[model samples]
Target: MKNKKILLAVCGSVSFYKAYEIISLLKSEGADVRVMLSDGALRFANLISFEALVQNRVLSSISEDWQSGLNHINYSKNDLIIIAPASANTINKIAHGVADNVFLQTILASTCPKLIAPAANNNMLENFTTKNSLEILSKNGYDICEPVSKILACGDLGKGALADPQIIVEMAKRTLNQDNFYKGKKVVVTGGATTEKIDDVRGITNFSSGKMAKALADAFYYAGAELTFISSNEFSAPYPIIKFSSSEELLNAINSQNLSQNDLLVMCAAVSDYKPKTKFNGKMKKSQNELNLELVLNTDILKSLNLNCKKIGFKMEMDRALAKQNAINMLNSKNLNAVCLNVLDEKIKFGSDQTKIDFITPNGEFDTGFDTKPNIAQKITELAKQI
Candidate 1:
């Protein structure tokens, strides 16, 4: 990690003082640190103090040194850039690509992964515009370190305080170590089943409990990827989650973002393959005799994600031959990196806590015998590292 360079950008916020502690903590962890401050940041902290602490010059503006032709581009080349106490205004600028200041300019020019810790007044943080901007930034692959809820300097008690410096340092360390194999990668995981609404509350869905998807998300997160867990309303993960209720909604959410080469899309959702052709305005009444429901094909999430980004799909089969064939077919048909095949005969899938999986990649196939979800997740992360 010492070989990796880190750029710490400070913005104008009462939490600016905490940024100093962050710099020292990162330096202690063997990272080469450089400091960049927004013009407003200097009001709270002095450049001299930053320089003395990092033993490097504090960069404030493009005009600070004409000898350096483009400071923003040079600073942007670091391995990981973090903006501690990122003001609401600065966060908005970053989301919209408004490079009005040196900090924003460097962020715009940066190709490395970014982590932002936003600190603002409670009202500003909860504002609709700020919320939308944060969503945009998240979709664009930014790791948002959630702020803590505490008494604000403005005499309000709510969210918007900078997270603990220790947490910030840990996140920065993870982001700096690209050789750790999965650092800074964005992974979109689809989990659970989409509910096709029949009425205001009634719907048709599946039995998928999203356990596999949640496992995958947790594994990917531990592997250092900025994960987006896209799931149906029935599924929930212990990490950052994005929920959807229908196939159309899930499709729209996936299509709304621009995924790059480094991004990995995991289509683990057991989406409903069929849905009612027509939804009823009210709940269907009890049937007197045998009733038939017409079903229509729902959107194929795996195929769509395959077209969008590098994808990993899952197939559950009852027969070994069919499982292998389906895995190979998915690899060829969808151009996936790999397919995780599960045989349902073991009864260790779906809502089960344990699973046995056969991994079929472009190079070969391997099986991980009945194991706990955590172990399965570890194996998946290992495979991802190889990729």
Candidate 2:
């Protein structure tokens, strides 16, 4: 946040007081923050409060003096704009280009990135009009910190609370440093365990949770990469995702993506090794006797890709020696530039947040000791920098 200019626009809500803490934290992080209070904001806090915290004049209204008249224009040149405790009315106005006041006028005139944290009654928040307005703002490229669901001052349990201050600040830092490594690069990440349908009611799948892929996607996005995330997981991705359910569907998704030599592909998904040769049209009936099933090997998606992009694959082994062997086999047979190896264990089982990953490449092996998903992603990102 060092030397970054941030503009804070506070709207009316009980959570408005949190804005002071936000400003203080940003300032402590070496950021230069300028505050503006919406008309409704005065209901929760007066101008004197913010003035004392910021140690600068709180911009509430346009000054009559021509020299002071351009304060909005000058302050709007911030690197980022944060609107906390954004009411439903404020959201609508910002969405529709309503700039009747200095605060709105400054936002209207500035091209800096925006992050809005809305706080309102449940009814107002769930209103269809508010939903459409937020969608419009998002489509227009505004970053939103979605309101949390909690007991409001009105005694309703629903979404309307302001996001935590730490989250807002972290997002600010991420937005400000978006020009890090991998900026303007194209990245493709595959996640989750693909299933093979056995019958109408059941299928075969692994225990993958897609957490690793999500972590890598987040890191790549923060680094400014244009990412295409293909996943079979039921969890929502941080960014827009191209979803698939089965191995065939995942393979098709991979085939459909436009990949090139400059692109980076992380094949982290656990695609099914085999699929039932014939799927039952209806739910398979239970029987007292054992049932015989025929199966066929599924296509190897990594080897099937014809692109010249750099590729990474994952191999889960039951033992350390087998892991090394399988890693080398995948690196050579699948034409992967690198392979990540993990030993299947009770503690480091699938879907676990902690993982001990070893990256094998032609140059050497890199071990990222037992670490969380985010730290593992950082290690992978550092390797991406070298590549």
**Which predicted model would earn the best lDDT?**
2
- Give me candidate 2's TM-score against the actual structure: 0.67
Error of 2 at 64 (Å): 17
TM-score of each: 0.58, 0.67
Q: In model 1, where is the ten-residue run with the lowest total lDDT?
A: 171-180
Candidate 1 differs from the real structure by a C-alpha RMSD in angstroms, to one decimal, of 10.3
On residues 142-231, what C-alpha lDDT tens digit does candidate 1 reach at each position?
A: 878889899999999999899988878766654543335666678888888888987667788878888888888767775777778888
Quick one: how many clashes does candidate 1 have?
A: 0
Instruction: Summarize candidate 2's per-residue lDDT along 1-387 as a digit string, tens digits.
Output: 777888899998889988988998999989988788888887678878887887767777633133664367887888999999789999999899999987788889999888888889978978998999999998897878888899998999998888888768766765775755676678889999988989978998888899998888777766667777898875544455899989888888887878788779989898888989999998888875899889999888887776788998989898876779888988899887888888877779877999988888977889999999987986887786655
Residue pairs in steric clash, candidate 2? none
